[model samples]
Target chain A: MFELQAPLIARREVASGMWVLSFSAPEVAATARAGQFVNLLLRPGPLLRRPFSVYRATSGVVEVLLKPVGAGTAGLAALALGESVSLLGPLGSGFQLDQAAGSVALVSGGLGVAPMPLAARAAAALGLQVHWVHGARTAAELCSEWEGRRVHWATDDGSIGYHGSVLAAIPEGIGQVVACGPNRMLAALAARFPRAQVAIETYMGCGTGVCLGCAVPRTSGVYDRACKEGPVYQANDIRWDVLPQHLHYGLGA
Target chain B: MSGLRVGGVELRSPVLAASGTFGYGTEVPLCDRPRLGGMVSKGIFLQPRPGTPPPRIVETPSGMLNAIGLQGPGVEALIRDYCPLWAEWDFPVLVNINGESVDEYAELAARLDGVPGVSGLEINISCPNVREGGMFFGKDPAQAAAVTAAVRRSTRLPVWVKLTPAVSDLAEVARACESAGADALCAINTLVGMSFDLGTGRPRLAFGTGGLSGPAIRPIAVHLAHQAAQSVAIPVIGIGGIGGAEDALEFLYAGCQAVQIGTATFIDPNAIGKTMEALEALDWRRLVEGTRAAISSG
Candidate 1:
């Protein structure tokens, strides 16, 4: 909930158009959880703040992964070393993992892998066996592997591990599943598994939950704000059918 | 720093956080809640509104377009859940009221009358009047006057009518509200606008059209504030795209009694606090002497 001018500590391109940025935000790094996000203020012209999931946090530093999809993110990607950026976070409810579960699965598609690295580290700390399943259009888009963890990959063009959707690569007998990505992939995951927690992506204003702009329909017939009630929700709690068709794919980040 | 007296309430500073941007002023940590002049809460309605579906907001150059549809928890929930918290804060809290009809506006004012922790009312006439075939109350001076008069009669609290920038004659509407017993005038609300997605060949926002706010609208807002201040006898609270002390000075030089910080809060959560700091650093003595010299030279 604190706003700070965090100086860029490190910036590296992990994929073709994707990057990982680390910032020196001690307070946010200290308090941020696995599923929460940070809203980065872009250049003045585009007034809307861009929200990015917390990729990693350790010892007075926090990292966020982003792809240059539009003007807001492109502005972020263009920042130089030692530049100070305005950051408002750590925001929204992140993935809630069950401590009692013996085994867990982390499913990610496309840029959805932004939040999984931290989730993988957290699940390992909780004494649960973690499995990572990742998918993209090609092998170059797949994120680099997490050290000392079992990782599975899927590519649509048959250039990687499995020649199908990442949903097909997930093994059975997983006690719990956590996912993040485009809505269509999330919908498929929700339909296939009953015990799944998903982090949703939507258009938001004032990421602090005051504007009520980021709304997702719930199974209970009420719209819940994705900023406050969650960017993360239990799979069955969402009413996916009522969501707009354009939102089903890769539009929102 | 000197304070501002609007209607019956006295504020610590003249820079207040605008409605819909600052939330309840509870979660903002760096904002220095007690030092703020005042804060307007989010728009409240007779019943809870679900608001428009996603994409409710979109970026448009130096501004943003949003059609949040005034989503709120209704009047009863505000009284039950948030008023107790407001009562604890040292600063005054003005409730922004929105309604579907003249009667609904009056009823909402009546319900808030004499309520503890409630400092005043700022009527949001920008919403569509369901009884009038979806025409907005603020768009027409006569309808705006009627709504203001109804609320003025219903409550003893100080009333400030929030006017829209989309109207043709903003001064006419300002005068109309002043004639109907409004204590002050808050000028101006967001300009009605829209944006389209080029790739998808559709409107960027789900509602198709929305209200635009930010630095892009500042010059237009200053022009309207100047007009409204000239036309009305009541104090004018200037709003729309105020980011820093310089922007606020434009409204003050234009004759506004106070200014409200809106879209800037989205950029920095402590924008109000920062603006207050910047204002305190200014030499008022020099500014007054300069103004006097200019007037004499002319």
Candidate 2:
């Protein structure tokens, strides 16, 4: 819960709108849990604090995957290496990892794969054989790279490893599924297994629970906040059906 | 004597971070705020409300409007989860409790009673409720008094009424809260504002109308703060367009004992701590004397 102004160590353009930002936070990197996010305050105007899930964390470096959709991320991507940005986080409740599970598979889409790279490493730490299954529009979008962990790639264009959605190739022995992506992908995965923990993204006013801008409906006929109760939730717990049917992410019951 | 004795509690610093702007105590990221002041967390309602749809905020000229709709996990969640975290910190994390019904507000206030981390309550009366609740309690003097009286009786914690500038008679409402035994007053919540989306011909924000904040509302906020301070003997905490110590000084000069930092924190979460330091560094007594002499000579 401590706030420290961390020095930006490295910033690289991963893709057109995608960026890889690394900060020096040994305490946060060493102990930051999966699915927890850090709120990045972008200076100037129009944009304020933006919350991005922790992508991957090294000994003293915490990397976040960001898509520059607005002024905040765009400004963040433009920061110099030695520049310091006000970051208050390693916040919000992260993914719920079940250690006793035998076979584990990770499903992700677009920049939604932000938390999975670290989750895979954590799974390896738990001695679980993990399979990283990632889905993107094409080969260019699959920016996730795992060194020793197994990764299975899928793209919509038939341009990558698997020529279909990652949902289509859920391993037969998968005892547990962890996902972060469009709501549609999560719901589809949920419908397939009716079991999986998913990280939901909501454009929040305050990435912390106080604002309550980021809330999703739960099966109990109530809404659960993304910042507090979960950035992650079990498939059956979220009320996907109650969501407006317009967004591409939450489609499919 | 420096500690502000507002009703039942004494705030070490009169200044506080406005609600809905600062997250929980931990969300602000300062190692500690034993120096600056206190933090007012986002609004908490009786039940969990999904709130308004997406595109919740829109930037206007020198301001930003937000119709966040009091999205929250209910007041119980705040007590159960957020309070424990606040207890770990040294500063008082005041909870801003809101609700559609007086009973709901009372229930929330009752729930917060005896909570370890809760220092006080700031009642936000500007929440544009879509449910059974007609409008904000602050808009109507009678209702504001009733709500304030109810929450005041429900908890022993000091109660502060956060007034919205949208009301017709701001003095009437501020006076009502004072009569109802409010400890302090935070005048001028965000003003109602809107923006257009030429691309889709729809409103820029998913919610049609949003609360306007930032420099655009500063004058109006200061005006209300001055008026409210004059109307009641209780201390008034000015809010709006307070991006720095200079802005805060304006509010203090206008008669508010303290001021809050809102929209500015979005750009720099550390704006509060930095501004606090900058203000403390100034020879305020000498500056005040200089300004007094100038005003007298002029």
Candidate 1 lDDT tens digits, B15-126: 8988888777665666766558899998888898777767777777778778877777899999988888888887889999988789999999999998888899989986
Instruction: Give the lDDT of residue B127 in candidate 2.
Output: 62
TM-score of 1: 0.95
RMSD of 2: 5.0
Candidate 2 off by > 4 Å: A13-17, A147-149, A243-253, B1-3, B6-9, B20-33, B36-123, B130-137, B140-160, B168-184, B194-208, B214-216, B230-234, B262-273, B283-298
Clashes of each: 1, 3
Task: Let me know the DockQ for model 2.
Answer: 0.19
* lDDT, candidate 2, B60-85, per-residue tens: 66676787777777887878888988
Name the TM-score of chain A in model 2.
0.91
**Candidate 1 error regions (>4 Å):** A43-45, A244-253, B1-3, B128-135, B284-297
The local distance difference test score of model 2 is: 0.75
| Model 1: docking quality category | medium
